[model samples]
Target: MRDPDAFYPGSRTREEWLAECAFDQACGGATITPGGAPLPGTEQAEQQPAEPAPAPAAPDPTTATIEDVAEFAPDPPQVVGEPDGIGVVGMPTNFVVDATEHTVTGDIFDIPVTVRFTPVSYVFDYGDGTRRETTSPGTSWQDLDVPQFTATDTSHSYGEPGEYEVGVTIRYAAEADAGGGWFPIAGLLELTAPTTVIRIVDVDTALVERTCAEDPSGPGC
Candidate 1:
């Protein structure tokens, strides 16, 4: 029998034939040169360097203004006291107010940002034609090492018996941080505390000779 390889002299092998067919199909049946090289234009296209991947877009600016910082300011101040509802005429009543720090976080122009609100001062309105402003919330008598019913920096005395409303306003300073160091925000913002009412009454005293133990129901025991 004749050898299969001798059937076609000067013809390509089966692998070469399949490869040429695949190339023809890929190039839409375009003609290939003797060494199976692509056409001129096709060779140029294959040799051309690919464009560098587009650089990632730069991040947007994180600029902020006082008004923008104000948007994240702290809530109203909280009033702290012991006898929150009662007071005595001609007596000293201690009052204190404070506000907790708050962190405000959000996006500005697609860039993340953070701002903090810090309390600077508190303004107290006694609602009886008297007002006081303090840099720090005053401490209690025990904490201040002072005696009870004594006048203090944050204490008030009532001259007449009546009901009075008390309130406080907190002022906050803002600072912004956006990938860089924190910077103070211009201007200040204020928030008012809820109104609180106190009833003031007068007290009278009398001296008795008998001891409170001797007279369980004495007039001024």
Candidate 2:
């Protein structure tokens, strides 16, 4: 067994000179208490309940779903049609759409979040009992360096003449940022713009003696 005096500083043998040095240099001449007993008031500080583990760190934005940002979804795309509200039978009438990415701030599961909606695709309803889906938002003939009525990917020829209601639906993919970088949300959100009314008319041609430009009131003018 170890000697008790060797373990206890007070009972251990010490030279007179060493004891004098320790008495003058240690504890600022105050009484010293040993052992693991915490200092007064330190016990309460150490038992402060650990700050609740930092509140579980609100969920990562990556876990967000499309439904979470549904309410903040972007508005429908802007639809523009060539010939501006009119078309000709057997002639292709073009269509175009415009959409921009936008962000909205709202709460998801009680966590503040910012969501961005980006247009991904366009579905055009020509209102002639036909629908076409395309990734390209049709460009105008002038922009394409092509003549008007020329058939393009987004242009459609009317089988008959009448008044038609044209419509477009835009598909939007969403991303969320909850104080962190953006992350893609699952699924897409679709929204439809107001319908545009178009009138289709049939054109008739006849041989004339003079051109319409030559004569102010020429035949078939």
Candidate 3:
């Protein structure tokens, strides 16, 4: 029948109370504290320590404001994509078996390259000769460490166990190719030719991290 805020001394809002004090029982269920004195068994209230707040989260992917484009952006990255942005030369076209815990690390570009930053989407041609597209990638550098970036395609996580190949293709912003041709830049980047990689099996993981340890047989392998 009394105000809920009148009882909780540390907070006023229901949200704050729910987050900080609801689980805590040191307050002795005191619905009210007249003259800041405990209504009843409030001795533990003074003895209890304040709970530490949770750590802040990493940046969110949604509802974040971003630059619409990188027009005339300085010192832009060199994009060594499929020559003309088709899928390119030596990418992880095929997959190889590795522990699921192992973080994949490899460079798939012939060299770093640059782009106009005017692209609707991109495709990645995994070396084994398969291609995948981003469907509709909204241009934004907010999600990546690099600037003036775009999402070509994402890697597939093997939910269970299986072999798979990977590839990508990047569709440019130009509706038509050079000289007003629909199939223009595709030929330039060799769109018809998707990059290639062989099949790779996902395996079980034991130790994702490693410490210094010499083989029992010798100093080093």
Candidate 4:
């Protein structure tokens, strides 16, 4: 048989051809060049052991901060007045809000993350230049087993009769869970609930000989 190396432009032996085939198989199908040198990118592939998929690139790992998860925190339900937006002057108008704990799931740095928000405290703005902060969200008089217009932790009394816009700010303590167990984030996030308008009116009291039902035209009826 004629020398196969004579037919080729460069000198190469059958052993060299077999070696190149073996290299190609080892490198996952890298093409060989003249003189038995593998292609540019394939050279490294052929020499290096098949690297393990880069180890999945590891997770971002940077711990999330409170500010990072603030956007996901939703405002608590608006401050609910016991009388549904109407209160009498000089009487305590009870207030209550839904301070339920909640959780939100989203992606942070392309990693799955879950955030939990717990209402820590509440700041009530009575809109009469009066503000009160309380740990309790306060319950209605009925819920508290009391009569209406009764003073409660969240109640406010207006000195004068007027229309006021009541607002509440809920401070939430946040915790994060990124595949690992839940961990607390430093600081608290304050979310403002929608303002509710309450009408405050003045009333006069008078002693009558009979009830309004008995005499519709009684004094101060």
Candidate 5:
């Protein structure tokens, strides 16, 4: 008869080899008996079925709405100029204004998001039936190195004397970021600043022969 020890390659005995083959069959692998015959259940164990993977998560519906994006809209712009009053009638009054860039960060539907706002254009309403639009925020006459009443991009002259309600509307553009590159929002937004009341009056000039220093408040001294 052929020797059973020659069928196995290792130095294990017959009983040890049988135990190893039984362990391999339990672990979903093929097994062979000491006599070189395949085990009855080894093939079925080796072909055990696999479990299906879990499905992916669904997207949030709130993040796709307009109201969600509008929540990140910028606040109203601040109007900068002489708060007390302005110059007299026919004078070149500079309507200076400025708007700084701002950022808002928060979560949208459990997803982190960031929004940025920047001023793009300025519309000035002088309250005298005249309106002007410009890219600059305008500067004072002294800053522009020019004399008063000189025509400038943002300077306006009051034709008559009265109280004018000066107001400005600022246009802002928005951009969004969600762990990716920045992209522009669908539409532009406009914000109007509080109206400013300024008094405009006509100045009268007089010429006198005597000096005003001696007369104190006499005549047009």
Candidate 6:
């Protein structure tokens, strides 16, 4: 209950206020003259108890923490294309090959080469002693080298950094198999080597065919 003499700011207790209003003589609860009769209808009105303060709303369910904020920070660094944009044919030029952001990143990339000679045999030499001997239409990194043919895919990496001339030499042998079936081979292009841990490229031209005789006496021998 609030003390009326205490200089408090707000209203007094609900009960006291109600009583003050109910028994005030002018508002009608006083007794009349001689008979001491009550003035009228003002007996303290029934006071309703204050509604229990609403239970403090349950603290919002949450686990906000440093880890939670860190989890949603931002993105990490990234390099979209090949390192320095290095490119290769069927072999590595400078020994070093462009490593896919992933191969170096654990992702592997495979390129294909198709060989065609009217009706003879064409081989894909992976430059690692392994030869991909195939009919006309064929796959290089297949069989993995043996009586059949070297698999269509080969893997190699460079040791150091430097300008390396990597390329493929395609030779059209006069079919050591066929009595006379040959064609001009190629692979005489040059380009800058990539700067990745390990990169690979494919080519389709010269190798070992140094003499003019190896240059196909004609077009299709």
Candidate with top lDDT is 4
Q: Which scores better on TM-score, 3 or 5? A: 5
Screening candidate 2 with a backbone cut-off below 3 angstroms (N, C-alpha, C), the clashing residue pairs are: none
Which stretches of candidate 3 lie above 4 Å from their native place? 1-118, 123-132, 135-153, 159-163, 175-193, 207-212, 216-221
Q: Model 6 off-target regions past 4 Å? A: 1-55, 58-72, 80-83, 87-202, 209-221
Pick out the ten consecutive residues of candidate 4 with the lowest summed lDDT.
25-34
lDDT of 2 by residue, 59-164 (tens): 4445455677789987676677788768899999898877777799988777788887766667899999999977677888889998888898888888999988
lDDT, candidate 4, 41-97, per-residue tens: 543332446755433324332334567778889766978886878888899998898
Cα miss at 161, model 1 (Å)? 1.2
Question: Which candidate order results from sorting by lDDT in descending order?
Answer: 4, 2, 1, 5, 3, 6
Predictions ranked by TM-score, top down? 4, 2, 1, 5, 3, 6
CA lDDT, every prediction? Answer: 0.61, 0.67, 0.27, 0.68, 0.59, 0.25
Q: How many clashing pairs per prediction, in order?
A: 0, 0, 32, 0, 0, 31
Kindly report which residue stretches of model 5 are placed more than 4 angstroms away from their true locations once superposed: 1-68, 80-84, 108-110, 145-150, 210-215
lDDT of 3: 0.27
lDDT of 4 at 85: 83
Better candidate by lDDT, 1 or 5? 1
Worst 10 residues of 2 by lDDT: 23-32
The TM-score between candidate 2 and the true structure equals 0.69
Residue 187 Cα positional deviation in candidate 4, in Å, after optimal superposition: 1.9
lDDT of 6 by residue, 65-162 (tens): 11212222222222111223233443222111221111011110111211221112223333334444333223222222332222223232333333
Model 1 spans with C-alpha error above 4 angstroms: 1-63, 211-214
RMSD (Cα, Å) for all candidates, in order, is: 28.6, 26.1, 26.3, 23.7, 27.0, 38.3
- The all-Cα superposition gives candidate 4 an RMSD in Å to the true structure of 23.7
Q: Distance (Å) between predicted and true CA of 158, model 3?
A: 3.0
lDDT of 5: 0.59
